[model samples]
Target: MSSNNTSQIAAASALGRLSPVANAPSLESIVAAATQLVPLLREQGQQTEINRRLSEEMSRRFEEAGFYRLMQPARYGGYEYGFTAMMDLISEIGRGCASSAWAAALGVIHNWLLALFPEQAQDDVWGPTPNALMCGSYAPVTMAEPTEGGWLIQGKWKFASNVDNSQWAVLGVQFPPAEKGAPPGAGFVVVPRREWTIEDDWFVAGQAGTGSKTVVIGKPSFVPAHRRLLFPEAASGKAPGTAVNTNPVYTIPFLAAMPVCLASPLLGAAQGAIDVFVDMCGSRVTRGGAGGGGNRLSGFSHVQSRLAGAAAAVDAARLVLDRDTSEVEHTVSAGNAISVDKRIRNRRGHAYSAKLCHGAIQDLFTTVGASGLTLDQPIQRIWRDGNMIAQHITLNWDAVSTMAGQQMLGLEPKGAY
Candidate 1:
């Protein structure tokens, strides 16, 4: 067998030996190592803000650790590893630095998403460098027209995450018919950064370091037709990735996967809070005598109970997500339709995971005392970032619940995705 094939066999053998029901790495070890690296991230957090993006040093560390390659096809520079491990890894990063994790999460997942594009689009993005990073905004931010070989593209796509560093982007648009608004059909049009300029638009009260700017593409540029994609297929239960990837994990619904990827960073940020709170609570000596028994916060029955509940929520939410991914993977792998019931379950589970982590983080913030209120505090950043990101529709638990409930009751729910 070839050397590459040998490596795959060896890795698969090792994974088999582990016999993890999830078929992934030891989540704890990954979390521990990533947690240890958080302080280093925290030290450079201000620098990231000043640079208006993640520091090259931080990005290099992530790349060196093979973090960016998590979602890449193994034939390229990637592990093609378990989706669970990817979630564990991103959560750790989020705990330390939400924006870095958010940016990295977006950039990394884009690699996987590329596998869903047409081979020509894949060539346009990854043909250059397997490690080539791409970022994008999907909310139809411009006008695109049917033309020979490509679309005549114009307009600025906003919320383009990690744009300052990305080599390419997937700017989605709805191509209107020659007639005024004949049914709307969506397509993701690929554009190289060289053909577009990034506007400084990501300044905000939270996730400030994401550098989620806008891509301003005008008269000077357009993406070819081969680099574009149809939407109804993805919205229903299809994606081009199956033809190229042959990986069951990539077979999951396109819109479904977006929220799953996003909630991960938020969970990681909360876990980061938990890690710190545990440390801080362990070392404290309150007026009540080492908070009594020298166990610090652990000695306080109420604190212990809260921690227990929060930890339970975190674990519970993770289990739901794990179950959802597995089901999605299994069904799609077999060429089955992902039922509306399952999709609703997936959405509800995703929103709950985000909410669970949000509640846990909020509880920790309240319990961490005045130290967290300072601008220099790590918990403060985590608290702000988590709260802000949880507001995203993906984590809006009420909406997910409402939709799921309506669907179960044989009622139609409204929304594009």
Candidate 2:
């Protein structure tokens, strides 16, 4: 049998032994399912990059593993495990393939994002197909025209990740000002697949497997009022969907903890780099160096130090992610609003963790010598993916640090938290 079929059969056997409910697997069992896919993911990493998108079998595998439902409402056949659980699961997937993990991370987190929309929007998505997934573009680059019952949107939304697998899209657009002379407000409008077309425009040097193409609305599409969610409302603990979903997980601010999904995959990619580095070190020998031709790479002090530093950095990043995410979950569950200070701190944690992970991968990549430059080397791919992730607007170290520092110094923070 093919590896894909064999993997499916094995996953089925494991599920039969572990989870009684296929839709709502226990955290341990679900994580175990992700763990089992790691080898397959690693095996497919090259092909995934080559295709510039995740395979149908891979998407199906993730769905069967129940990874996408980690943060969805239980009423919608999800586990509602919250952000930390998502971080843990995505990080494990990252250890195998960062691009796949990136796509999967967004797939899972968008479920939580959808839960923050109005009840009608939620039902529109999951009421008919509970397993349906969504892709999103978060920059409000165009303004929506006020229509009779809702709004008419026409434009292209870039970087809609995992667009190939998604049945719906949450597009960012500016709504007309509530009052004359007021500035237009930014928010999201949920549109079904029929309303938009996917543009094949995601060619990039890193994270190519995410399939983050452009979503184009060639003609004006009418989105009902109930399908819209304003940014401010999402940033607040109480969103329109909160009344019905009522999960503390949905109450957490959008930018406060959502960036963790972006950082979690980098954390896993850094660890994966370390794993490949160590394995390479164990067998590699110097060919032509001042020291000697046959000396073992691992016996060198520089190699050992790089490994230690990289491991420490990865550990520190994981700690920051866990602490901040856990704190958010605890505060929201206790009925407390996520304070501004906490939000900025969490933002700092997200950026700093990405910095740490990128640094770790960079340190490891430098030690790999000329062989690491080859396309087949996983370390090179990890390094590129890490760099790409760190450069994301949400995780960019300089921007995030400046925002946090401004908040700390009693100046109004300038950017999204």
Best candidate, TM-score: 2
Please list the C-alpha lDDT of all candidates, in the order they appear: 0.73, 0.89
Indicate the worst ten consecutive residues by lDDT in candidate 2.
Answer: 12-21
Instruction: Report the C-alpha lDDT of model 2 over 88-203, residue by residue, as the tens digit.
Output: 89999999999999999999999999999999999999999999989999999899999899999999999998999999999999998999999999999899999999999888
lDDT of 1 by residue, 367-404 (tens): 86765687777777788888878888767977778887
By lDDT, the best candidate is 2
Q: Give RMSD (Å) of candidate 1 vs. truth.
A: 6.3
Report the alpha-carbon TM-score of model 1 versus the true structure: 0.86
